[model samples]
Target: FGKENPLKANEWVRTFGATAGDPEGARLNLWAPAEARSAGGKSEIGYWGMELGRMLVESEQMPVCLINGAVGGTRIDQHQRNVADPEDVRTIYGRLLWRVRAAGLTHGIRAILWHQGENDQGADGPTGGFGYETYEKYFVSLAGDWKRDYPNVQRYYAFQIWPKSCAMGVNGSDNRLRDVQRRLPRLFSNLTVIATLGVKPPGGCHFPAAGYAQFAGYLHPLMRQQLYGHARTASEFPGLQRAYFVSQRRDEVVLEFDQPMQWSDSLMNQFFLAGQSGLVQSGAVEGNRVILKLREPAAGTSITYLDSARWNPENLLIGVNGLAALTFCDVPIDEQ
Candidate 1:
């Protein structure tokens, strides 16, 4: 197996060196739903990770090791539950999430790979389990909660239910299942749904073997698309939405966005400050927009934001951008 190992080390540095690495690639962690570890045996889940990892090397990007977080026979609600779900390994997503949070690497999360729904397709008729509304409720909440949790994790949900290959009309004739798939992404800002309808629908519709992972050819490419899209969206981070009042009396700065934001370092990839004399000072984000106290008290400073179609947390303040001094946000782009 002589592969070029096509990507050279410094090439990444030379090309993307200007930008801050998303919290050191090698050290950044991934959390997903692999089955619970038993005393001596592995869960019956498939081995699609190796295939995924191999394809990644082909992409000219560094090979990233993924942490398995999926479990067997679990459904969608399982992944979104904030409370620990004992049916599947409890608090797994939460535990890894805490560490990622404590490490303060929100931006390090590029995307979440979700392959669920085998358990929910009881049927898809107007009266079937798929027709029920509970899945949608959980999905909508999950999107907001993930934003609330990581603030920087963009998700790519793979709707794993599908076009039944054998006996298409029976076992799991849930067309409504597909409808929900099409609908989930519209409710959240940073989510995308990978339509897996054409893939071989489970023959048993209840369980499938590890070789069933053949669908990765379709599923994995979609995963790549979503990950790249997340990066592009995040680069547009910290676009301000509103500036209610800038007072000269207390030298106070009061800002408001239709969406709420936390000032985390994840948001400050490479921020700068512009002084009145046309001199710009650069900064880093750990809490909020990095700013130096007005050296002259009245030196005066303003902020920056996207005047275009940026996700307006102002609409409801998506998540806080916890940052350090120097990075500033909510700089109102005049509404024209």
Candidate 2:
């Protein structure tokens, strides 16, 4: 996911300033235009944040506000805090902080929907050697700064960038960054990773309106469960539990998921093996596990999914709830 530039009329409107219909006296007051009406009589439909807010307002009958801070074509370093002056508007992080404070929302933030990293995934330039360790360090510092500033913020919904959307050519470093992103939840207690593997209209660095709407559809329900305690019976978000060889020979590997899985298509060619194996000849679902049959004897010491960052829109391994599996790279294959 990326910034929705030139925001559509009703998709998202100014929450602060006189334009939002706040008291003209307080020009800086920020308010959620939950029922905001344009000059026309019809109510406005939305894409990502708006759609999610609409669902929350309709289902829970509560007001939801989205404070968007995403800036297109920005690297992780650009978002680093200006420790010398946290409110220095010249810096990206400082500017966002200044805006939030100006709107009297320093403490009102409940969650953050973060969709970035496209700019940082480039094969060269700023992202040339920006592997997992560098990104993790920068992001950790960013998160710490946020927690210090916005103490009440509870959740961080980070969107894992797809290889197809990388601004530069795909490489192992890009997928390595993705692997780090998908593992963010483990690094922070309040963070959760949202996979972008199977999202539609996926060729661009930024998704179109329809693709974002689809993303909102997948996100709203999980938000309901996480923030509202709506669905507590089972895991609403699914992830890879473990991957291991089915036998010592390693001819077959099994990818176990936290939930039952289903494939959208026959081809699971996205998987690759390292070590002695040639390739993943074929794969199939067996209950909660994906059995990958190697063309040769199973001798690989490691396995990787979404190998080479191939973009397959229709073919995906998804959970029963329809959430796609997060791309994992060089996951160690456990011996039986």
Best by TM-score: 2
Question: What would the per-residue lDDT of candidate 2 be over residues 6-35, giving only the tens digit for each residue?
Answer: 243332333432222223322334454522
Query: Candidates' TM-scores?
Result: 0.44, 0.82
- Show how many residue pairs clash in every candidate, following the order shown: 45, 2
List residue ranges in candidate 1 displaced over 4 A: 1-46, 83-89, 95-106, 123-131, 163-173, 200-213, 223-226, 229-336
Q: Counting only residues 3 or more apart in sequence or on different chains, how many pairs clash (N, Cα, C under 3 Å) in candidate 2?
A: 2
Per-candidate RMSD, Å? 19.4, 5.3
Predicted structure 1, TM vs. truth: 0.44
lDDT value, residue 251 of candidate 2: 81
The pairs that clash in candidate 2 are 250-298, 251-298
Quote the positional error of residue 157 for candidate 2 in Å.
Answer: 0.4
